[model samples]
Target: MVDHKQYTYRVIWSEDDGEFVALCAEFPSLSFLAPEQSAALEGLVDLVRDVVADMAANGETVPAPLTGKRYSGKFQVRVPPEQHRSLAIKAAEQGISLNRLVSSMLSV
Candidate 1:
């Protein structure tokens, strides 16, 4: 079983639930809500551990933790033709490649 701690976990206040909610990115469907942030996170960790064990016991594929994965620093994004043209023109005006311009925009 994958280590539950290896998964990407986040605890945030949920306006709808009026409680702190813990979420595991890899297991989108799973969440734990509690009045306290620590409790929410701990509960979600236990939930992830159990789910991972069950998946292993059932011989089902389990998702790899985001922390354990390698990133290539490259991804593809598609934009509308007009938006693409605008971005390209902006990049040219700035004397930079589209990729660099997009990277700068995203960084901001």
Candidate 2:
């Protein structure tokens, strides 16, 4: 049997759009969009599997989890109330905590 622990996907809901988004927490880069949370999650899983398979075929190593020491910093910004609400809703629908969503975007 193939090793199953190599890949995994997670589902999150977006409150603003009222739809679910899939995120591959294990492989942060793998994500998918769908009308429903379940569909998005399923799609992400398949996508990650395909990516892993392709990497294996090409004799490439699957990336390992992040481990290097991370730096800490802080900043402040102003956003309209409506925009903040929309962002919160979107974060909720993606099933990710708002902090994570914001952090991910900021990192990018």
Candidate 3:
């Protein structure tokens, strides 16, 4: 089982709440709201650790952390012919490979 600390956590400021909110992507149901980003992150991580420990005591399956996951860096996408042609033409005009164009688009 992956450690709770290995899970991906993000502390983001909430405009409406006027505070920092910490969220663990692996455990979407859990969040911590705090005045500061550090406190929010710490609260969220502590909750995650407790949750993981409780899950272990109950013999429940724990979620795998995203940090240690590996990606193949390759995937296949199918688009309509017109869209494909347009992308090819755009890539050609930009003087970049179609793969690079698509990668740039997705990154943005």
The lDDT values for all models are 0.96, 0.73, 0.95
- How many backbone clashes does every candidate have? 0, 11, 0
Residue-wise C-alpha lDDT for candidate 1, range 50-89, written one tens digit per residue: 9999999999999999998889999999999999999999
Q: List the residue pairs that clash in candidate 3.
A: none
Worst 10 residues of 2 by lDDT: 1-10
lDDT of 3: 0.95
Those runs of model 2 whose alpha carbons end farther than 4 Å from true positions after fitting are 1-6, 15-18, 64-108
- Candidate number of the best TM-score: 1
List the candidates' TM-scores in order: 0.95, 0.49, 0.85
Candidate 3 per-residue C-alpha lDDT over 6-60 given as tens digits, one digit per residue, 9 for 90 to 100: 9999999999899999999999999999999999999999999999999999999
Best by lDDT: 1
Worst 10-residue stretch by lDDT in candidate 1?
A: 1-10
Candidate 2 lDDT over 27-98, as tens digits, reads: 776678889877897787778778877887888886653343255666666889998898899899999987
What is the total number of backbone clashes in candidate 3?
Answer: 0
At residue 99, give the lDDT of candidate 1: 98
